[model samples]
Target: MKVNELFKEELKVINMGLRSFADDVKSQDVPVLHVDWRPVAGGNKKLSSLLSKLKSK
Candidate 1:
């Protein structure tokens, strides 16, 4: 599947045919599954990096 990486999320590309009611009714029964990835980096690391680079007020 052509996947894009952004917003720290992975998405599956669905075809228009699969979205139609006729396809759902006439086609063989199929199941769709979704998988999610967990964050590898801690929140503190991201915050500290930003804080270190913050422009002085």
Candidate 2:
């Protein structure tokens, strides 16, 4: 239950939603897995539908 014990194994992290946070973690030499996140339809339903249709082609 100590920090050292917890890190006895390689530490891995999945960074969600924030690229700057992940970059900071990487700067400290830790491995970071970044997932690209965005708001659904970017808050625009019409644009979302248009993008979806374009991608289906």
Give TM per candidate: 0.20, 0.52
lDDT of 1 by residue, 1-57 (tens): 324454356432334333464345435444433224333345578875676577443
The weakest ten consecutive residues by lDDT in model 2 span 36-45
Q: How many backbone overlaps does candidate 2 show? A: 0
CA lDDT of every candidate? 0.45, 0.87
Collision pairs in model 2? none
* Candidate 2 local distance difference test against the native: 0.87
After TM-score superposition, the amount by which residue 30's alpha carbon in candidate 2 deviates from its true location, in angstroms, is: 0.6
Q: Top model by TM-score, which number?
A: 2
**Once superposed on the true structure, which residue ranges of model 1 sit more than 4 Å away at CA?**
1-43, 55-57
Residue-wise C-alpha lDDT for candidate 2, range 1-57, written one tens digit per residue? 688887797787899987999999999999999998776587798988888899999
